[model samples]
Target: MMKSSATHYGSIAQFFHWCTAILVLVAFMYGPGGPEHRVYSPVHEFDRRLHETLGLSVCALTFVRLLWRTIYTRPEVPPASRLMVAMATAVQWMLYLLLLALPMTAVIGAWLEGHSVTLVAGWEIPPLFATSHDVGGAIASIHKWLGDAIMWLAGLHAFAALFHHVILKDEVLITMLPSWLTMGRARTGR
Candidate 1:
């Protein structure tokens, strides 16, 4: 019999999922410590560029992932309590929205700051708006807070996945685990 839903996400989805996670973690670690300690120096500039590059990469990956999701069905996770399912669905959608909004905000902020955004290998993305320090600062603040929210959401997501895997002994978490890591038993029919 044919499966009703995917057993595990394909390689491309898994790749983007893990890569985005790592990039987000790195971005958080590199962001300004606090408002009082904000300093514009060479090192800070380098970090900002790196952060921008990663953010752009994330935006590209998110677009591709969204397109893929539109074309393909997601794997079916085992049933959970209604409350748990609803919460998980909400979190998932929020993550998706963040993935879309965060990078666009960063790009807009960069343009407002009179900085050119260079993609990997030095390809420049033309600015979409005129330079405005005040606007840039405001967008920067929003970007930072959104990033902080993502970090908290990621923690919650990881905790919930672990709970389903370890505490509930459900396939919810395993279904997303890479096949090699899960010893090829992660798949569930439909």
Candidate 2:
């Protein structure tokens, strides 16, 4: 089914989830890390443009996913400790927040630095804000930190899901797995 059932997220939700994850990972890999000069250098142009494009895509997808959540009912997770539930919620929100903030910071920082956001096909989005090198540099620094933070947090998120599947022996992970990946197992979960 395309729509989510009480037992599991729909195909659409799973698609959004996995696609966002892949994009985030790829963008992170393409990120031109190091000093601003090195990052903005012609040597890294393609990588930077691809990274920014992927970041923008992630931002757009995340917004749509949030909107989808409002209209679609999510699967009901199995019972867990209140603390565990709260932790899960916190991590989820943090991931969403990073998904939005990373791109925003990248664009704003580039704009502040008097640079345009370059995309594929040589498309460019010019900076809207007045140049403020110092402030922009600071924001860029934060963006780098956030980039690192997301990787670590995503690692934690995956670890938690695996814990639920292996240690807890629950349906938490299976509920989100694609049907093909589930190998025709009962939808009711293992």
Candidate 3:
């Protein structure tokens, strides 16, 4: 049995990473399947609320994840092409930015429209801007576009990770897996 040199991310980091990933995917898919996609009621307000709630959750999780990264040492890198490394780094930071910005802009837009931003029956965040439908609409537009951009970037990240795992035969993907899983795989000669 061989020891795993794959340094998995801390449990907290991994949890946040996967949680956010799933939530983001759900939000994206739910957007298109709105009221128009269903034969039942003309619209699914439930799905829209779910998407908004999850989007806000992502924002909160991202804040904690960023703080955790600042305090902890990230995994060491396996050697790769400079271009690949650079592209990966760029995608990572961009993901962080989009994750934080999307929810924030939504919240701001809501505020400008005189709507309270609430988290799943929790307390509401008070409006921070003057009521203005025009302003809210513009900000919401930016938020939507940014969400789409993040979705594309996430797809690229997944593809790149798979490429490293299958084609490059590197530790890139394993390093982000749970520690126990990575260790078990190494012991099994994977």
Candidate 4:
């Protein structure tokens, strides 16, 4: 059950997929910086903590997912047009790259700025340097820009999956759904 079968994703793969998706969404919502941030408020504090912890979790999960993926082949999706299949494959690759790159950039950016990633489990990652914030500003800028781009791409990925389900009337989306939900379902929505 841990390794994905030819027919559908295994439980572990599904778990990682959904968890990473949710974490990325939460992080994006709390990701804004500068003037948008309130210096001292519960919401702001919550945002900071959530972003830090969730980002870290995403990074860690991505590694596990990648390792699992490399060792195991993904489930065989139902037949679809070559174009659609290629599109899906490209989007997946982009997402995986983003999953790895974004968090690292953000983490290194924070470190360069002399800040610690206060992990939720009661540990803090120290800064990479003591007093050199020279590259922090640039890295921070890239982080924001790349973050926006990745969110847009994620939206497109979701839209494409829905397109395959609702418009194309395929199980491309269903196969990825949890077993309990996909039991008798043909596709997403009506």
Model 2 spans with C-alpha error above 4 angstroms: 187-189
TM-score of 4: 0.86
Clash counts for all predictions = 0, 0, 1, 0
Which pairs of residues have clashing backbones in candidate 4? Answer: none
In TM-score terms, candidate 2 sits at: 0.97
lDDT (C-alpha, whole model) for all candidates? 0.75, 0.94, 0.77, 0.79
Give Cα distance to truth, residue 75, candidate 2, Å: 0.4
| lDDT assessment of candidate 2 | 0.94
Best by TM-score: 2
Compared with the true structure, what per-residue lDDT tens digits does model 2 show for residues 1-190? 7889998889999999999999999999999999889999999999999999999999999999999999999999689999999999999999999999999999999999999999977899999979999999999999999999999999999999999989998889988998788876667445
The runs of at least 3 residues in candidate 3 whose Cα sits more than 4 Å from the true structure, single-residue gaps closed, are 1-6, 32-43
- Clashing pairs for model 1 are none
In model 2, what are the clashing residue pairs, if there are any? none
Clashes of 2: 0
Q: Which residues of candidate 4, in runs, are more than 4 Å off? A: 35-43, 186-190
Q: Residue by residue across 57-86, what tens digits does model 4's lDDT show?
A: 899999999998888878886888798788
RMSD of 4: 3.1
| lDDT per residue (tens digit) for residues 36-104 in model 3 | 225113365555566678888899899998888887777777787899789999999999999999889
Q: Rank all candidate structures by their TM-score, best first, as comma-separated numbers.
A: 2, 4, 1, 3
Residue 148 deviation, candidate 1, in Å? 0.4
Work out the TM-score per prediction: 0.84, 0.97, 0.84, 0.86
Q: What C-alpha lDDT, on a 0 to 100 scale, does residue 163 get in candidate 4?
A: 91
Compose the digit string of candidate 1's lDDT tens values, residues 26-84: 86676543441252454466666667778877888888877877877788856778998
- When sorted by lDDT, best at the front, the candidate numbers are 2, 4, 3, 1
